[model samples]
Target: MPDKYEAELPDEVHELLAAADKDREIRLTRAATAENLKFLELVRSKVKDVPLFWAVTLLSHPELGQAASSTSDKEVFKYLTDVELVQDAHDPREYEIVFHFKENPYFTNTELRKKYSLPNGTKPAPADGTITDEMRAFEAIDLEPSSMTIEWKADNDLIAKHPRKLNSEDDEIIDGDIGSFFHFFTEKSDIMSLGGTIIDVLAEPLEFFANDPSGFDSDFDEEDEEDEGSIDLGDDDDEDEPQRKKQKKERCCHP
Candidate 1:
């Protein structure tokens, strides 16, 4: 267990926690690795940035605007790739998000990707010789802001209004205190604090989920499966919530 929060977590978060715990063992078995890799390929092909963008959108709300600095993003990302957990002041939901992102693999620039080419293909070889199919490499995720561009879903229903009046004399001077969400993205684009934002906003929906998780158990499995890939929150489970919580074998990521 990676220290449960003092606050009760959402069921989906619980499901995620349970899975993360078992992943350490699952990664050691070659059979598990092959199955999980299939699932990962399925997800990487079908769900590219669903988690990343959804996480950011959840944070962009007035109450959940991210405060973590870019350095925090960098450090947290290091922890994420290493499958370790660290205390985060900016987001209480750090434990949950980090475990979820554990599958994000090591990626590189054009030069490095070129250096490790796989046999005849342009694709890079495994990150290192030790890299095996059992490794949880969610390499499809492009965390670098410069390498990725996002198209926000139309803002019609997505807008969040400010809860506090920016009445200070220099309120206009403060960048974050300004009036628009699009502007915030534009300003933060250069700094690469986008990762921090992804980490921070997770709390918003999670807090919402901690209460309901909007029925996440159906999509996630309690028993480690050979072909499981990733979290698909929309799916529904047959077991009632209380019973699902009792299972210890629940796995987190396919990898």
Candidate 2:
């Protein structure tokens, strides 16, 4: 946005972006269990008129968040992105996901496990443990973006073997987001802040997660160009116009 549309956009938009990037959230609009998805869609469409940057509190769509919170190893994305998998500092044996970029850091490891097994192989009480990984993760992070942070002190392997819990749902989402996130920054000339200390994460090669490591679908570019003009935002009137249904109407933010 800064490179392509900045000059053309009004100064008001610029200020909006600046304020938005500074804003933060710990959760999305959290409703009852049944209304979880309903509230999520509410926020996504609510910000339609607002600039994308102005979307300060929306963390995930109901679909993504709900799906992410599940405990199964479902496919989170169609592919993966390059990343540096590290161990959380407080729990150096557990996990951490640090984007390869110097400035960008993704979610931490302890956040991904749904229900970790205690040393005695017992699920801790809610009061004793935190909701993590799979479906619980979605409910926690997506529902409460304002309460969460990308950085975590972490629970060590003695706390739980996070890597062994491999659900792949967060894996997919995290990897894809890493790719998409850096794709935006890489387009720009540069940014500041260097944080490579995460290299001490596992000392092994980064975790591999590309379903199509061979890039078999790379040739679909022709299809992408062909479908470009065929697509239109108006294609989904129901999604754009909330009033069409009784339903309804939303990021954590940063520089």
Candidate 3:
């Protein structure tokens, strides 16, 4: 037997070390536990619909508590995968995610990592980048419409008082129709002043008047001309006389 002590010690130590190394490898492969999966899933679900820039902002930077608090690690992973945020790489553990700013789409790896605040351990590698003229033009344009219409109505008294002049205070008066003096008084109030009475009556729902389409249509046709002529019943008597006479003559001759 040639050095039996040396042979035994060397074989035993080597075998033991080999077993430990195998166990360590197994543990490293299983590092992403169920808890990690759950967290990633939650983060993914929350940020899936959010913009890519926002998603990256939340996931890459742990300092933004607002983004981190709302999501879990599982959700983050899921969103990353779903959005194809991570690209294929030689190392399965590593990922490549790209962010594009349309106007200046070209970005270096260092710039992107710095701007996005990537994790300390993460390694970013830039591919190709381009900024099309179409993209630049779209970014420069304001897409919102210049004007919009809102349905509204004016108080009859206000309309009556400023018959000749458009209502300065409420330029958005889309409709102005109140019934005759008797109807206004009987249904609305005993206010003798035409302006005040008309306003009060007009404030009430026109359900009764609106219910009969034929009657409403006929009245609308008759009053449409009056409205077009800018004749307000509450206007000064002297100023309204000529307009009233002209309207009367038109009704008699035209009818």
Candidate 4:
């Protein structure tokens, strides 16, 4: 893992530590490093601190949120860890959480229309009521539609609130890019909950990449070229028509 603080720490800071073998500065530097490492380890340990089952349950039946209201942090942690569903974090105790919802292909449009009270004879329903068969199937598989944009602030606050050696001010700003990517992948899974907030933070970059024009520009250009080539083929056929008529006339005369 990249050193969490490497980017923030000045280059001279390490040199200062190396040069001062017997000085108080060296002792302070060593102590700081130890403290930071320990803090990160603690964060890693908590990556699985949230319960995946509870998250899924609550997401599928949001009504169950009341039942899980009493769930302790340690219980949630154990559940997540038991299932080997841990978030990758810069520190051991800090975990990025991901919640995913994926579409199920098995369910047909007719089934969804019947199940969700969709308007009959689909001329395409209104945007608010638009639930495709695939979307309904996804819901059946425990994936829920979320209008919630991934909230990074919540994750940042959660990390900051955790007891650690690093000062709140010194806490590394969790990169939004990592959080977004994690969320993008997780959103495809059958889990959901408030814990998804963590995953959303990780998936920000992924969402950005998906929408970014730079990545798709080349493919778009290739497709355009292929379309142009097809148009040229149509022109070629038109050009060949007169020659085909001439050959037919000659053959008729000879016969």
Best by lDDT: 1
If both were scored by TM-score, which would come out higher, candidate 3 or candidate 4?
A: 3
After superposition on all CA atoms, what RMSD does each candidate show versus the true structure? 19.1, 21.6, 32.9, 29.8
Clashes of each: 8, 23, 14, 23
Per-model lDDT: 0.29, 0.22, 0.25, 0.26
lDDT of 3 at 188: 21
Tens-digit per-residue lDDT, 1-255, candidate 2: 355553466899987765454322111211121242344245335533422111111112212122122111111111122233332222221222332212212323323211111233323323422332331222211211111123423331111211212124432233222111222122111111111111211121111111112211122221243211110111212231211111111011111
> Which residue pairs in model 1 clash with each other?
10-210, 19-251, 19-252, 59-201, 209-213, 218-236, 218-237, 222-250
* lDDT, ranked from best to worst: 1, 4, 3, 2
Q: For this target, which candidate reaches the highest TM-score against the unseen true structure?
A: 1
Give the winner by lDDT: 1 or 4: 1
Greater-TM-score candidate between 1 and 4: 1
* Model 3 poorest ten-residue lDDT run: 246-255
TM-score, candidate number 1:
0.22
Measured against the true structure, the TM-scores of the candidates, in listed sequence, are 0.22, 0.16, 0.20, 0.15
> Candidate 3's residue-wise lDDT over 172-236, tens digit each?
22333221221211222222222221112222212212222211112222144321211111212
lDDT (Cα, tens digit) per residue for candidate 4, span 138-164 = 212232222223232323322122222
Which structure is stronger by TM-score: 1 or 3?
A: 1
Higher-TM-score candidate of 2 and 3 = 3
